[model samples]
Target: MANLAAVVGIGQTKYTTKRGDVSIAGLVREAAANALEDAGLGWDDIEAVIIGKAPDMFEGVIMPEIYLTDALGCNGKPMLRVHTAGSVGGSTALVAASHVQSGTFKRVLTVAFEKQSESNAMWALSTPQPFSVHLNAGAGGYFAPIIREYMRRSEAPYDVGIKVAVKDRLHGARNPLAHLQKPDITLQEVEESFMLWDPLRFLEACPSSDGACAMVIASEDLAEQSPKPPAWIRGVAMRSEPTMYAGREEVSPQAGRDCAADVYQQAGITDPRRDLDCAEVYVPFSWYEPMWLENLGFAAEGEGWKLTMEGATSLDEGGDIPWNPSGGVLCSNPIGASGMIRFAEAARQVRGDAGAHQVEGAKLALGHAYGGGAQFFSMWVVGSEKS
Candidate 1:
């Protein structure tokens, strides 16, 4: 059995379209330093380090973690690099936690980053892969038709995407670290914005950003030494399925369903809607909010959009189950770091450190991420208590 592990610290740099002020190493260091500061620890306190990011082509740097070791203070310590497409960040954290859970380490440091200004992400993502369709419109192009399929099957309102765009942008305004903060954003603007993908407007798409996120995971004994309350990790899980196959439901993939089911079961959650206090889900595109809701079993198939229309996912006082109170991928998507942001945000909430976006009395929370044709999934549940 795995021993207890807790996320005792989280830190992130100010996300933006371009972080010209810092080098890739500097960007990674900034986030790692902040997390160390939050944990009240120094470089010597860390037992190991794990770093993750997207393809080396995205930043034109090969095995960045090797160079980032000095910046992240991993000298002479075990360091691992993880690349699981966009889900790398969350996966990185899970790998770090595994160290503590296995009784192999007392404390672990994990970081993920993306310096999009170094290279063009769109150009990298759009490159034609062997045996894949050559439409080459980038990720949005690939996911848009899938989104359209969800719309057709669900019969959701035309404004559902607009509503999510408005909600998340407004939430982003409150999070100073977010890249896009449109507090005054409205449904009308999103509805009128130029359409990039059919049924997906420009305002609804996640920005290509340069940013980093870091966290410190520790054993139970070490966790109790933290100055701030620890966000105990109740359960962590990952799942993957073949990228393409006949009759696969990309809209609600079985891998995603299985991932969520496994995590919730690990957390002993029988009724997610009523049991969990809040959730931070990966929503790179506005429509994904509802699509993931069904995949995660938070709402029934073809009815997830109804929850959005009714404001059930709002951060406002009107909603009970606040989703993405930190604005989520729709706000500050540093591709490689987006997934960990969701995971870290969930830990922040349970630790009562969410600041303005804090969900009051959120004893338990969920963090989720998916990547690569929506086939790879990663998730975790965190809570205030050790249990």
Candidate 2:
């Protein structure tokens, strides 16, 4: 219903455990600069900026975008900060794209980042709020129960999680920008890793990395004139529900399903696994691959693990769908930037610029992100050609 929008540039900082060399502003600028270079444009070409992250407490800085405007080249331009828990990155990009899609801006810049080294994520996640039970443990503690429920409901083997860990780690090795490049990763090693939660091992959890991801989106006309091939945004959608509500299924949230359905409808995808050449899903935990596979309609409920077991997610398997060729969140998770990385990776596949992690002959790709007790979801479908 709005003017078509396409991604002309994508950039990301090298992921690391600690980016002490640069301040948060500097980290974001590096990504923004790279995106501009890739777009064959300059800071002067950007009309506005959209920044996203999880929580201010994580960095001990409130309203960081205000101080970051200059670093992001947003002086004298409209700027917005998006925070939808973990899906903030994807939501931020979607908001920026809307400006282009509405014909309100020719080119817009969107950036997301997180310096987890600034603070312990476990402590940040466990901060107690009034009238809420304090769960002193970290994200693994919060999510392990949901995974346990999935295992029980689906009858998934215990080794399925280990398999996912091994696969994603191997995939991460191919992504030069990934934080964890465990080239020698093996299923035996994953199985032997120290258990963090009941069923989750340290290797199965996403790393708290310092990184940033950025993208330049433009209107259809502007994109057509760009030097680089544009990754046309076929569809974008976001959905949210209360963090905890009666009758809500935490493992397969309705928000994720509804968001996928809306985007798929706009993209004209009748069969996701068959139509989508690849996907970049937010999987901070290895188990989420199969859980999302089912939620995204790539496989029948209780059968998602079957795909993972069959090596259907591998790049060389010639499987119907390849997911997380960028190594995904399991390999590098800058909480604020994780979602944008997924979106950016999808764009890269469509732009034919994924380098070693590229899915062969990829034409259509899905990008997905979720946050906040799995209650928020953002997704986009991209293609090589204009729709």
Candidate 2 has an lDDT of 0.93
Q: Give the TM-score of candidate 1.
A: 0.98
lDDT of 1 by residue, 1-387 (tens): 889999988989999999888999999999999999999998999999999898899988889877888898888999999989878888888988999999999999999898888878889988887896776688898899999999999999889999999988877888999999798898899999999999899999998899999999999999998998999999899999988899888999999899889989989998888999999999999999999889899899999998888898998646878899999999998888899999999999999999888888999999988889898889999999977
Score each candidate by Cα lDDT. Answer: 0.91, 0.93
TM, every model: 0.98, 0.99
Model 2: residues >4 Å from true position, as ranges? none
- Taking every candidate in turn, the Cα RMSD to the unseen true structure, in Å, is 0.9, 0.9
Clashes of each: 0, 0
**Lowest summed lDDT over 10 consecutive residues: which window, candidate 1?**
313-322
Error of 1 at 321 (Å): 0.8
Candidate 2 residues 1-387, lDDT tens each?
878999999989999999999999999999999999999999999999999988998998899999999899899999999999999989998998998988889999999999999966777889899999998977788899999999999999999889888888888889999999998988889999999998999999999999999999999989999999999999999999998878989989999999999999999999999999999999999899999999999999999999999989977455568889889999999999999999999999999999999998899999999998898899999999877
